[model samples]
Target: MNTIDEQLWDYIDGNLDAAQASIIKEKIDTDAEVKNQYEELLRFNLTFDKIELEEPSMSFTRNVMESVAIVPAPVAMKTQVDKKIIYSIGGFFIISLLALFGYVLYNSNLTMPGFDQKINFNFNLDKYITPTTVYSFLFADLVIGLIFLDRFLRDKIVQSKKI
Candidate 1:
């Protein structure tokens, strides 16, 4: 027979084995202090369990559905021109440009303010495209490409192994 206060409390709360429960019941009936303690705990448990849960209004779900119904579904836009139509428009533009060029050649002002003075605009290509500049640019491109390739290969290997 268990006389420990915790064991007695457990048995009273319906958490004890059948044999243990009998022992606690015998103790509670015989001991006044144990009986009073058990009653107090039971009362607290019942009081908390009886507290009511709050409910929302009956129209809450209906109001939410009404709001959702008011909103319009998103619509997708349709294309007006296909590939053939785009090609036809491009052909028309080219033909118009050719006609304009022919008209300009046939009639244009041959005299200008600075017609006698020739403007010689020469850009030194050597300054920009040196051997060192080309090599450094190529090296930087190679490094960036290598980094992406390494990541792609690693991911492919992992996926292949998983499969």
Candidate 2:
């Protein structure tokens, strides 16, 4: 709205100090436009004062709370996982690892020397243990460690939230 309406509103609400109120009062008395606006605002204020606000029924809050209570509480996404599914996945991985280890051992060739014969241990591990192999193994270990740490932290957070 214009400054005139704002000043008139302030004057009607008695928000303006004596000096500002007197200036607005003088304008309302002398200017026909100002006088008309002031009378309209005064009628609106009186109408607003006469209005009776309707209140809600006494059981409104109780009814709303009862409906809310009938609805189920939300469950965490992680908590929705079934224990049987996790156990099955873990069992599958364990069995696969055991089978792989057995296959490796069964295919390998190694001879055990008799007690009467001298045992010769002349195997060089340098060929199998290259720098790249070592770095890859370390990187794999770091990635696995981070995965485990992440799982541990997530579980901790879920547990804390439950409390």
Number of clashes in every candidate structure? 0, 0
What tens digits encode model 2's per-residue C-alpha lDDT throughout 1-163?
9999999888988999999999999999899999999999999889998999999999999999999999999976674689899999999999999999999999997666674777789878998899999999999999999999999999999999989
In model 1, pairs of residues that clash are: none
Which runs in model 2 stand beyond 4 Å of their true positions? 70-163
Number of clashing pairs, model 1? Answer: 0
Q: For residues 1-163, could you state the per-residue lDDT of candidate 1 as single tens digits?
A: 4446577557757898888888888988999988897888788778878999788799999999999999987778876768898899999999999999999978997667856877778989999999999999999999999999999999999999979
Candidate 1: lDDT of 20? 80
Alpha carbon lDDT at 44, candidate 2: 89
